[model samples]
Target: MSDSKSKRLRDPVHGLIVFAETEPLDLLAWELIDTPEFQRLRRIRQLGVSKFTFPGATHTRFAHSVGVFDNARTLTKVISREMKRNEQIFDAPRSEVAIIAALLHDLGHGPFSHTFEGVQESRGVKKRHETWTADIIRNPNGSIRGLLERYRVGFCEEVAKLLEAEDPQDIYHAVVSSSFDADRLDYLRRDKLMTGTGAGAIDFDWLIDNVRVAEIDIGAPEDDEPVNKVSTFCLASKALPAAEQFLLARYTLHQQVYFHKATRCAEHMIGKLLRSISTVANNGKNVEKMTGLRKEHPLIRFFGKNGECVENYLALDDTVIMGSLNALTAASDKTISEVADRLCNRRLYKTLDVADVGHDDGKKRQRQRTITRDFEAEIKAGSVMIDEKASISIYSEIGGDDDRTHKKLHILDGGKPVEISRLSDIIKALEKKEQFTRFYFEKEEDREKAQRKKGQNHD
Candidate 1:
């Protein structure tokens, strides 16, 4: 590709993303972008039902992926410059692999993004989006894998390994998957911008410039033993405020955008619809035939006994799911029709925050079981059907005891490497968990009936 032939894409979040012919990796990235599998991401919503809550959050995974690739490029250039200044050997190929891994990180996200994962998990399917991503990348028949192989013999496998964190100790590996990686950096800013939530503001340029590779001793070192020093990504002491802002941005995004009550309600409706559709489809019924769907309905494979065929998975996106929902609004099965109608018409389930719900894992489960039994008893006793939906835990375990990323992150204070928590109280506070549980009802009348029964029981 010549300089004149190089492509430049304009992005609202990242300004401009360029695929310069002068850069081999950029050209390769452009090639990957042109593939069908990568292009499918344009149809998958990045924030799932968050658009219902934040109207401007109609951004797709394709845009987010592009933003991530841009962030990776910026971070890699910074790392390369610092490595040269420090007289360290910078592996250009490894950096390229990291950049490519970042580009394809969310390739496996299904329709409605993370919301689809919740539906799959409820059905006892354990594979996450990352697992699907790895499968797609390693699939010999896939265009991404073919392109990677053509670029380098084992390049596809190398990229997959990086995505799977096979080389955790490698700094290049951290560039894509770590706590402060390009994925997080891009999503925080992009999400904030797209959702119109001006809460998450981080000086990305300062953070990128201040990032340095340092030798740090992870965890609590044993006494009288030489501390093992591993080269990992860290922020300079001068960038402590920037790092704090970044962490704050992540926390705020989760609170304001990711876990919005209305969005969760909409997501719960979708989950119920999927469950109803799956149940009907599993009974040897021709849902695709009845719905008159144009595309081969990929969801049929997901609802099948085996679960999630690659061919079917590739054909799925937000459009397919939305189209299916539109068709299902008139489904012959009442449950499927009602659920789909509610979702398509935005008549989402009403959520009631249960103050009595305990936070302890075991206690929470017991409370939930008791509430469910009572709710079902009411339903069996001829009360309106009421369903319970618990919001997924919004808290992240990033800086928790089990997490070792904090140990790897060092802040150079007075020419000495120090842990970031020691410098900022805001970052330390974010380490704690914040969780809420809510119950969902099919209708306001059902909720009233349940509450009346509960009051009568107390009397």
Candidate 2:
């Protein structure tokens, strides 16, 4: 025991977490606690549009970051004894990298978080948080990269790689990119604790304590079969419920928080607003240019050119967006502006639950057609426009073989390394499940109007 002083964090889930006698676990905390990039997390919402769906879900990324820091610290301690035994297996340097990776994993997340990225990717803009995160770390112009440089911890690329877990992804998967990662573990417990929702709760402490280090094939040399690269792994028994709970929590959060109808409506409206402004800027208009703006606020400059036209976008909390609805009750551009107003005012869009409808079913296709037409009518566009506007989840499984969870979770079963799905029935079950839900936006009034006009064969 190093007689380390008490560092208690009044966490929502675990109550007061006292890192007593912990060996300088404060390095990762200190590195992220005050950095500009980390601090910007204060400006970003965690559930994002979900706040509109669940009022209690108004937590920020700052809270999530801190929660992740705590989880990473716990994980490090859980494996500390193991790390100590195999000096070459889990060295101080690698442990430090894991901690840092956990701390800064979500640093590149911009305003409105993934919603903004979804809209951007739909427009053929190649922006990903991982890429932007890496850029910020190595960006010579940014404070974060500069701060890392100051500490001679300029391994931003490696940190980013761990955060990304690029390729043969099983070994580095748990660091930040998987269901059992620190970020997911922290958020599920933290969100459940904060929202008075037990649906996403998990025994994080148990999971952390039980984590094991196993030999993984991170391009191991031929003679290294006995032991290759040692990476974080867990037990086969823990694998089942741990993975089930993790995936189920993910599904529930998406349903209850991330894709709440109101939040989706607000995000959709915001996307429309940005699209309109971008059109104005790119169409040879003299309206202020949004060029070079951060991906979150690229429309800010275009809307007013200078001096933040939508101070609301800056002050645009969930409250601001809601308030904007009330303010826009009498505004011009009734369609676009009204949608914004309605979103802010809680006049939520109608949701069509497609969970019962399989992908290629005729009824599902009919429902999709109906919604597509309604969206077109609402925006006063044709099928082509609706086609252009439709947003799709960026399935990493472009080649079919590489699925989202295609990156396996490694578990050390009785001292032999195996893929999680191979050893755990629950993990195998998760492989067959769809962990995400898709929501299509169509105002009720627009749908009714499109329905009435359908009998007239109106193009």
What TM-scores do the predictions have? 0.86, 0.73
- Give the CA lDDT, 0 to 100, for residue 159 in model 1: 92
Tell me how far the alpha carbon of residue 264 in candidate 1 is from the true structure, in angstroms, after superposition: 1.0
Which candidate gets the maximum lDDT versus the true structure? 1
For candidate 1, the TM-score is 0.86
Question: Which pairs of residues clash in candidate 1, taking residues 3 or more apart in a chain or in different chains?
Answer: none
Tens-digit lDDT string for candidate 1 (1-459): 234377899998778788887787889999888899999999998888888888899888899999899988888887788789789989999999999999999898888766677778877787778878999999877888888998998999999888876335667777786656787777788888988877756897788878887766654568987765656678888898887777777667877777777887777677767766666556546665543332246776667655567767888888888877777766666667777777777887766554444456655545545556767754453222323432322225221222564333468887676877678777676665555565677768766654454323321
For candidate 1, what is the lDDT?
Answer: 0.73
Please count the clashing residue pairs in each candidate, in the order shown. Answer: 0, 3
lDDT of 1 at 22: 79
Whose TM-score is greatest here?
Answer: 1
Q: At residue 142, what lDDT does model 1 achieve?
A: 82
lDDT of residue 364 for candidate 1: 51
- CA error at residue 390 for candidate 1, angstroms: 7.9
lDDT of candidates 1 onward, in order: 0.73, 0.55
